[model samples]
Target: MQPTKTNIFLYLVAILVNLLSFSIGVSITWITSVIPKVDGSTITDDNPFGRLLTASEISWIAGFLPLGAAIGPLAVGKISDKIGRKKSLLILGCVNILSLVITVFAKQTVLFYISRFLAGVVLGSSYSVIPVFMAEISENHNRGALGCSVGIFVAIGMNFALVAGPYLSISVYSLLCISPLLIFVPGFFILSPETPWYLAARNDEKRLTKSLLKLRNKTVEEIHLEMTSILEVVVENETAAKAGVRDLCTNNTLRKSLLICLVIICLQQCGGIAAVLIYMPKIFEAAKTNLAPEICAIIVGVFQVFGTIVSSVVVDRLGRRILLLVSSVFTCLTLVTLGLYFRLNLSDVVWLSWLPLFSLVVYIFTFNVGLGPVPWVVMSELFPSNFTSIAAALTSSTCFMNTFIVTVTFPYLSTFLGMANCFFLFTVVTICGAIFIYMVLPETKGKSLQEIQKLLGSCG
Candidate 1:
């Protein structure tokens, strides 16, 4: 396809929105580097806080973000509907800025908890809004790649945190995290246009036309045809007067989409990703690797970024189902091997020590290729525009809740069930998730949103 002015602009907007995901990535992983510093026994006199934090305090600080994140989607979803997606995102970007400022100046443990919670709120709202915005603005042929940008940006952010956090002081790291938002906020406000779908839904004819003109490089006739299709759905949705939980339950197609989304998101979180990312340093510490723990964590982040880039490149061509199936199968095998390695390590197997780091790298890679990115991409594609904000909120909430549960409990689970058993459980979940994907999960490549609805409606 020949590139047009509109195509170039669309790519630019996609990159801008994905930057929000990158900022979120930094916020989410910031604690990973900071925790070991605060949790250590020696509270150096130069430390800003000038006190060592208790394990319980550190746990609460780490866990509070997901808890706050779970609430963010519920509130931000409705807000995004009232205000446009672009403005809602801008507001959330400011919220992230505020949270970072709090992190920089925080002297008390409660302040740290509050800052983390605020970061979680930003995460929830960003995940809820950005995917829908990207989906709405993108052409069908390239929507999958555009949607997968969330994962790519997130990987970038995580990589930044892993690489930078250990080297900088807490205040300096917090400042660095805020640097991206400075560009994202004003840049999005000044450069980006509101999504045509959102404008059409509000019945703003002049602005809608302008948006469609800016977003598409087609002839006037083609633009009219595209606008007509969007307006038709908007008019149909208007009769229902705003989608809610009732709509989700009463509409069979919507309900089916929700089921598929919920399952995919649950599997994504419950498959042990959040725990693995949060505890990566510790895992490296225990694995008997010659590399430093920070270096291992950075390596894992690199693999994650690589995997997401691969997904973004191939998702449009190979489609969602195939990649997800591949991800699930390899993830299961890696986890199983990791479990067995840990099990055998207890009996003095010297050669198996390298397996944990190797398994973790492969597992992170496999998870990012599909389970990490595809679920959110699918979530954005699955729901109608009218229902997307609310549906995504509920789905994002479920994801954060599961993350909270997994992150907070993983240590205890490791202590009680043993790390070997923990991996075994994750292995089983991955197998079940792969089976679920095989049985369900229709291919969404190159399908318009309305076409997707019809496709789901036809499925038994």
Candidate 2:
């Protein structure tokens, strides 16, 4: 069925808000552009420090972002619940801009570490709330597609950094990254509407009406019909005491939902994506590819973007379960081949030099199509509204923590174990991931929040 004008407006708003992800994408991969320049091997015009950083320091620079992100969701959860998702996002946008400004002006290694950590704070918080905000405002039929938009912008942002970080000065590149939020923060405040779910939860019927009016291009009767559905949810929620952290364990539906999200997110991170994305140029260099590492990185970034865009188009139509299963299985295959390519590259195999590039491209594309996006989509869908913020905080924290471990340890692991061994380890993890998905996960396509909760409750 063709979407209504309301659906189009919903999509436009979702795309705009996800500009936050674009900024994050730049921050995440900014290391790719600047790592070489700052290693003290050559004093470039843009190098801010006179001293060289240790290998450990460089890893911390990469690690600090996710480490800070691990803490951000904790605060953002309460803030989002108390103040509302829209305002919480605005606060994060402002904080994100501040972190970027610090990055642009940073002169000392300590200062750079602080700025990166703060940027990670924004990353964790944004991931915690953004998908829930998107889901809360959208209908069940289109929620998967909209949630997957998050990955598209993230990939685009990563591509932006990969493309621009190589040419721009460190300060100039950071300022360019900040430019999105300069528009996004103000535009979001003035143009974006508060989610009806938040308004309903607050029991502010008047504001709820205004929010719906702004979001939906529907007649009053149609708006009222939707409002009725939202109110039913709210009233149902009111019947129970407000959900607390305790509910996450005691409530069977919530416990299951949280477990599913955590496992999927863990699988997503352990697949070695964090290491590949943050250290893309370095990974290509390690593999001894014929293409310029920069060119190869950008090619992978472009493929990442294209894959996510395809995912956004097909997620609602295809159902989440199959996409995830296919994504995990193929991801396992690609990682195995990538590991083998790296292993064989050791022997001066000239004919198979092309294998690394082909394997990486397929790996990146397949990863984005499903595993990259589906976990977040499932995370957003499975929670009850009352416990969403709490569940998101927990899930977001776990996601970044796993990411931090993988990203921080990658250099040492690659050096000691060899890059091929690292991919082999990720391949093993991916196989386990596929098994988990097949054994436990339910298809959430076209299901309402209530329906999803019931489905989860019934699952073994």
Candidate 3:
């Protein structure tokens, strides 16, 4: 079914917002060499600790922005249901621009850390809420595509940054990351037409008609009929006091949905994607590649972005479950191979650089296609409108904590275990996660939040 032109516009909006939000850090990965060591004055790897950092510390630092970004969905979500989504997005865009400014001048490690922490907050709000906002505006038929655009933009943002970062100085790169905030170019001046459900929830039928007409390009009568389609089965939420955090847990359906969201995000982290993404330099270094760590990292970012775009093409066409499962299987093999190749003697002959390089490339591809997109998609889809505000908030918070855990620990973990062994652990976790998804996660490819609730109710 063809979506209204408005839906497509919203999809583009989602893509731009996500791309702008994620690309800043992705691009920064290339500039880490320029990030300065020994409290931001020295360029050498030498530090008082004598170990400056392992690949894991590098990986951990790579993840810090996401650690902050973890809050994006929840804090913004708490307010999005009350205020308009567009406005919430506007706040994030403005903040993104400012954060980039802070990053550009940051010299001290403390200053850079503060900049990243704030950037995390910017992403924390924009990326999480944007996808949910898109899902709300779309029907079940286009929900996956709309939602999947989150990943697509994420990939594009990373790609754009990767290409931009290596060639550009660190100062120019910071500004570039925030430039995608121009989403408000058309967004702010446009109608800001309401979602059909949002209009219905407000019980302002007259405004609902106006919003739907603008979206559907339908007549008054047709808009009314379409509004009824969503309103007929929709359950309007209670007062704010009722939607509190504790209340979300009390709802059995919401509880299960929360668990689903929680596990998927944890899986995303445990899979060590952030570690891989931010530390692409270290991954190549471990593999003994001839390329400079900075340049090799950029290549990984490029491939990661391409893989995400390819996933967008196949995502809805293939269905979420199968894609996720395939990602799990291939990811396991790739990680294991990379691990073993580095551990075992593989430098015996020329042309053997293919083994580790090929494994890392395929591993990146598998991750982009499956685990990378699925976490955001599933988290965005699993909640109903009634519970969306609090549920999304909780989900984002959980994601943030996991982000912190992985970011902080991954450095130490990678050092203790070889990057090879580190990946082997991730592989085992991902395999187990595949089993959990198969057994516990339900297919949400073509279902609205209402229909999904019914399915979950039935499962109960």
* Cα lDDT for residue 179, candidate 1: 89
Task: Give lDDT tens digits, candidate 2, residues 408-428.
Answer: 999999999998899999999
**What 10-residue stretch in candidate 2 is worst by lDDT?**
344-353
User: What is the lDDT, from 0 to 100, of the residue 275 in candidate 2?
Assistant: 93
Local accuracy of candidate 3 as per-residue lDDT tens digits, 1-460: 6666766665554554554545544533433443233323334423323334444344444555766777666667777778766667667667667766876776544555666766777666665666667666766666776666667667766666656665665666676665656555355436456566666766777877776666556678766666777676454444432666676577777678788888877787788776676556556666677766666655666777777777777777887888888888998898888777767756444577767666767887888887887777777776666566566666666766676676667668877876767888888888888998899888877777767777876775
lDDT of 1 by residue, 86-136 (tens): 999999999999999998888888898889899999898788888899888
TM-scores of the candidates are: 0.97, 0.97, 0.87
> Local distance difference test, per candidate?
0.87, 0.88, 0.66
Better of 1 and 3 by lDDT: 1
